[model samples]
Target: MNQSRKLCQLCGLPLTEDQSFLSLLGIMSTDSNNLCEDCCNQLVLINDIFCPNCGRLQATPEMCFDCIRWQNKGYPLLEHRAIYQYNDVMKTYMQQYKFNGDFLLKDLFNHDLIRLIDSIDKDIVVPIPVSHYTMQTRGFNQVSGMLNGQTLSDILSVTASKKDHQSQFGRRERMNRQQPFALSVSSQLVVGQRILLVDDVYTTGNTMYHAANLLYQAGAKTVKSISLAR
Candidate 1:
């Protein structure tokens, strides 16, 4: 089958032109989405009862312990929303798309993500930037790639190249993480604007805080984040 005819990006399964709903409605839809039904069903989306601050799944809607600690430490209260849980399937997907540099794999989540981003009210959308080394090797920032060519603020930048990653650290180390980002442009643009920070995953959330802290200091009115996976 021709690749243009729409095979699932993850499993390479040949997709029908449209699901049976089209036949029932007698409406022809031509949009070719990436993931197959089986692959889509495997994703564990975050539930309504989750931490309001960090978007972690929970029995009730409340701030998680980590978010409480963040507030106690004088960090600004930044609300976050995550689309899916970082389960074994998500881990494998991240490894293949990000670490393994499978560029096209981003299409699997792009449409869903764009729809989610659209629902949020923000003056600017800023994706966490990748280091120079990472961009050279990975060929793209995973967060930016997930936005599917949408216009995003390029204000935040990774200042220095460190051979370290947040995933390499323990929880304690992540909590003590130092600032890794800097503003590339003047803060005048960010002042008094509601900002939405975007990233591929939310681990310890050290990265988001690092970025939000700077944005708040730069005069952002409100800061919120969205990650594809928690």
Candidate 2:
């Protein structure tokens, strides 16, 4: 095994002892070395109860208050799923991978994200786009980086340059923000298609709703969404 690969990607710890005997003997592949078991366990997976509409962690698997508010506002309900809770571990991971431009960190979630996408029913997958300024400064779109080499529909694009980051805004401010995305391709391509919108995080559910609304208006049959965290 490569010495470099033996170090955990997140915490930079030695992964030798973390591997099972079979893996060390070449009978099985290494397990969870991209993140050591300790680091991996710190992430809270959203496998238990979560909201059906927005995938927010909750006591029951029902539509959350935020989703209910969106519903009351007459926005189309988006069936969204997320892989993990936006806990401290996930927050640090996002800070490093996204804000700090640590592109290699994307590999930490690529395999799991790909598997999750494969299980979804969708005609095409569209990643949420970043603004031109973000692309220039960040060098890559965080959401797209997690997709690995999967086929993606590059149809949606940023409507205009954003002067402020979404993180700077509160939930109410985010929900009140104007639509920030538009279709890059013709409506014919989206017509009657089951589109899956992908993003790095689900905040107030505003970004996903805005994107889904555009797709719905473009004649999409359905618009579902998934995020790395909520």
Candidate 3:
């Protein structure tokens, strides 16, 4: 499709004429499924000072209170990175892409995600898996959808069929929920490898920590995580 006819993936609006012109003439590069300038501007990238542990945006680069709490509980600090802030626009995008099952919306951030993953150093990239019930109903894992066909190690699986969605629980409930992940591969396979865990969002750091704990127990040398949003 021509640039002039291309529609913004998020808002479903046609690219502005000037944008098309610049893109067509090679003055500015653009993705095939681009977000219009307005919609793109609405996304708040976490480029400024942020919590080093959790990737949460903040005034300083120190660890946030949530990470401190996790440390106080004896959990090792996690080094995480996120692309965007979980703002109102991101919430809307996630609602449509995940809850509403708009599969094509995965392409909206495909290039960005691929770039982020490439920049991270790890021996294995393991996307956090959804419960079997979620896979049956949702037809896809949202984290895997955003990977854009990159290589991944399917080393983890859900521990059980969760009767309730994580979003349904409050902060305390989520933090207190039982571990939801188990390693699918042998401990020997994980030993001495640096594992990178990918997820759609990092809410309370509960899910990431749970997955990381299993990798560490199985003898992973290090565990790092990345998410599309914080």
Each prediction's TM-score versus the true structure: 0.86, 0.91, 0.92
* Deviation from native of the Cα of residue 171 in model 2, angstroms: 1.8
Compose the digit string of candidate 1's lDDT tens values, residues 33-126.
Answer: 5555566567787856889999998897869889999899998877899888898767878888998898878776776688778989999999
Give the higher-TM-score candidate: 1 or 2.
2
**Full-model lDDT for every candidate:** 0.81, 0.84, 0.85
lDDT of 3 by residue, 98-162 (tens): 88999989877777778888998899999999889889889999989988779989899997556
Better candidate number, 1 or 2, judged by lDDT: 2
Query: In angstroms, how far off is 140's CA in candidate 3?
Result: 0.7
Per-residue CA lDDT of model 2 for 94-138, tens digit only, reads 999998898988878887688789999999999999988899989
Q: Which portions of model 3 show Cα errors greater than 4 Å?
A: 21-33
The prediction achieving the highest TM-score against the true structure is 3
How many residue pairs clash (N, CA or C atoms closer than 3 angstroms) in each of the candidate models, in the order given?
A: 0, 0, 0
Models sorted by lDDT, best on top:
3, 2, 1
State the TM-score for model 2.
Answer: 0.91
Name the lDDT value of residue 135 in candidate 1.
Answer: 90
